[model samples]
Target: MKALVLAAGTGTRLRPVTHTGAKQLVPIANKPVLFYALEAISAAGIANVGIVVEPNADDIKKAVGDGSRFGVDVTYICQEQPLGLAHAVLVSQDFLGSDDFLMYLGDNYVGGGVTSVVEAFRHDRPSARILLTQVPDPTAFGVAELDDTGRVASLEEKPTRPKSDLAVMGVYLFTSEIHEGIREIKPSARGELEITHAIQWLIEQGRDVTATVNTSYWRDTGNVADILEVNRHVLDTTEGPGAAAGEVDPDSTLIGEVHLEEGARIVRSWVEGPVVIGAGTLITDARIGPYTSIAEDCRVSGSAIRSSILLSGSTVDGVSAIADSLIGRHASITTAAAGGDSHRLVLGDHTRIALAG
Candidate 1:
């Protein structure tokens, strides 16, 4: 079996950041979320992988390369536009060939990984199988209606009135039959060829469609909240190798759960855990704590950073505090503005703000 990872979307929701980088490349605990997916795919024993990317394919290609790093033979398929999920599969037909494959959303995060799912699919070889989870708001997702016997009877894509709370998770198992289904379908009112419609068509044609209720954690990291939530979830389970205090001053007080990467220096600061300070970062006279991922080459001085994911090349100036935020690459946050004593930020577009005085 092969794997197809859809990463073509423009990620409008994560703009400014997405404006410069692919959403899949955004760091969760200083590691790209896309890397996690690739790791999962590799762990599942599927090495031949096809990645569907947008016009900015070079960025993703450069980061993932030939997928050799992740133990997968990678193929990059370009999507002319953000048409839809089914359209992505349609374009990747050549790469996918006749093998049953796993279609994974590049920006989606499944907590337990797809190893077991892949194992089960390989064993049973169903025409198509969908991962489902009971969501509070099924209206936001493609929902599945289960029969009395617990079989998937119908599928609806973001319906006005959901028949079930079971939302279709981003992970999907598909056989070669989906190509024909994609070819036969028409675009939805949204002018996109949705995969949900194709699956419904397969079910209508009596194809052996199965649904597995995902009990483990699964999140589609489309928005900011989901991204942070996934980050927190991943960190909660992550056990670091303790604080690798490289250049810690005697006055500095480092507490539990700090991961100071190589060349990271902490001086006269108090740090509490689950903090992951990236390589070559400097933390001086600062309070770093709980749920902070400071990316490589960052400079933090006399500041407090908590519950945030700071991308590479950012700097937090003296006396500034940031929490519960996603800081973009090369961003600078300072204590004083040009006019007076107010926070100043050289930020990008779609930047969400909840300022603290």
Candidate 2:
């Protein structure tokens, strides 16, 4: 079977970060969100992959080039515009040909991966198979209603009054019959051919449309909160604290489950783990708290930070405390301003500040 990973959506929700870079490239635990999806696809043993990209997403092309590093031969398909999920499938028909394939949203993070689901799809050979998970807010997702036999009876895309709390997970497996459904369906009220509608079309035609409720972790990393939550989850479960690879002065204290990558230096600081310090980052006379990921080439000195993500080249100096934040690349944060005796901050690159001045 082949794979189609959709990475072309304009992530307006993650704004100003998405304004400059692809949302799929956002790092969770210092690894890009797209890399996790690609790893999941490779683990499912589908090597012939087609990545659907936006027209001008050259960064994505540069980052994922040919997919050889992931052991998958990838073909890049241009979607031209942010049409819809069904439209993505329609455009990828040539790459997919007649092969049964898995369609995965590139910005999604499915903990425990999709290996079992892929195996089940291969064995069952359903016309369409979707993963469902119970979500608190069904209105934000494409929801499904199940019949007495637990089959997918009906589907709706982001309904105001949802019939069920079972939201469709971003991973889907489909046979070639889905192409017919996609062609037969029209755009929704939102003026896009939603995948949910195409699945509903198949269900109307008496095709085998199946769904499996996911009990494991699954998150769509669209907003900052969700990204931080997923990062914390992954770190807690998969990557606990570890030995420091870079230099650590005797004055520094390393607490639980911290992963210090190569070239990371810690001096006169206290670091609490379940935290990952990327390579070449320096933390001196600072307090690094739990659930924080500091990216490469960053410097944190004379500050206290917790539960935050600092991208590469960011500097945090002389701050009292920074928490529950997302700091973008090349950004700088300092406590002193040119005139104010009070707090002064010069923030850049999608920086979010929750503290009151």
Candidate 3:
């Protein structure tokens, strides 16, 4: 089987970070979001992969060059316009000819990867397989309504009044019949070929379309909040029991599940985890709290921060407190004021901000 990853969407929500880079290349826990999907596809035992990209999205190509890093050979399929999922499949016909393949969204995070679901689809050989999970607002997502036997009876894209809470996930497994389904569907009201419509078309044809209700974790990291949330989940789930493998001083204190990457140093500081410090980062005389990830080469001195993401090469100096913030790459945040309180920030790349401390 092969894999098809869609990476062409211009992430308007995550600007101006996406202004300089592809949304798929955004890092969570110091690893690119697109890498997670590629690794998952590779873990599912799919070797040959196709990545659908816009003509201008070269960052994806440069970062994932040849896909050998993820143990997969990738073929770049160019989509001239930002159509839609079904349109992407239609354009990738040459690379995906006559092969069953897994379709993954580049920014979606499915906890525990796609190995089990791929194995299930390979055994059952369904015309199409989709994963669904409950979401609070079904109207914000394409939802699946299942029949008594748990087969996908119908699909609605962002319905005003959803029939069920089962929101469709970004991962899918499909046989060659999906190509015909895509061909039979027309552009939606949004002027794009909707994948839900094509899946509904397959169901109407009496094809074996399956739906699996996933109770585990899945998220589309399209915005800052979701990115931080996914980072917390990844760190908490994977980083077992705190380890001070880095150059932490004896005067420092580490609590909970903290993970200090190589060359990271915590000098005369206190860190309460579920926190991860990336390689070469320095935390001196600072208080690092939970649900925070400091990327590589960052510096946080004489500051207190919680529930924030400090991107690579950033610096935070003498801040009283920072909460629920996203400090971008190479950004510098400092406090010159004599007195200050907790602040919430969403700085972009290379930003410089000075607060009154």
Per-candidate total of colliding backbone pairs: 0, 3, 3
Decreasing lDDT order of the candidates? 3, 2, 1
**What are the TM-scores, per candidate, against the unseen true structure?**
0.94, 0.94, 0.95
lDDT of each candidate versus the true structure? 0.86, 0.89, 0.91
**Worst lDDT window (10 residues) for model 3?**
236-245
Provide C-alpha RMSD values for all models, in order: 2.6, 2.7, 1.6
Look at candidate 2 and give me any clashing residue pairs.
241-257, 241-258, 257-274
Best-fitting candidate, scored by lDDT: 3
The positional error of residue 21 in candidate 1, measured at the CA in angstroms, is 0.6
**Model 3, residue 199: C-alpha shift (Å):** 0.7
Q: Which lDDT tens digits does candidate 2 get at residues 1-357? A: 999999998888877767778889988999899999999999989999999998898989998998999989999999988879999999999999999999999999999899999999999998999999999999999999999998999999999999999999999999999999999999888789999999999999999999999999999999888998998998888753375477889999998888888999999999997889999999999999899989999999988888888888898887776777778877777765333323433244656443332
User: After superposition, which runs of candidate 3 have C-alpha atoms over 4 Å from their true positions?
Assistant: 240-245
Q: Which of candidates 2 and 3 reaches a greater lDDT?
A: 3
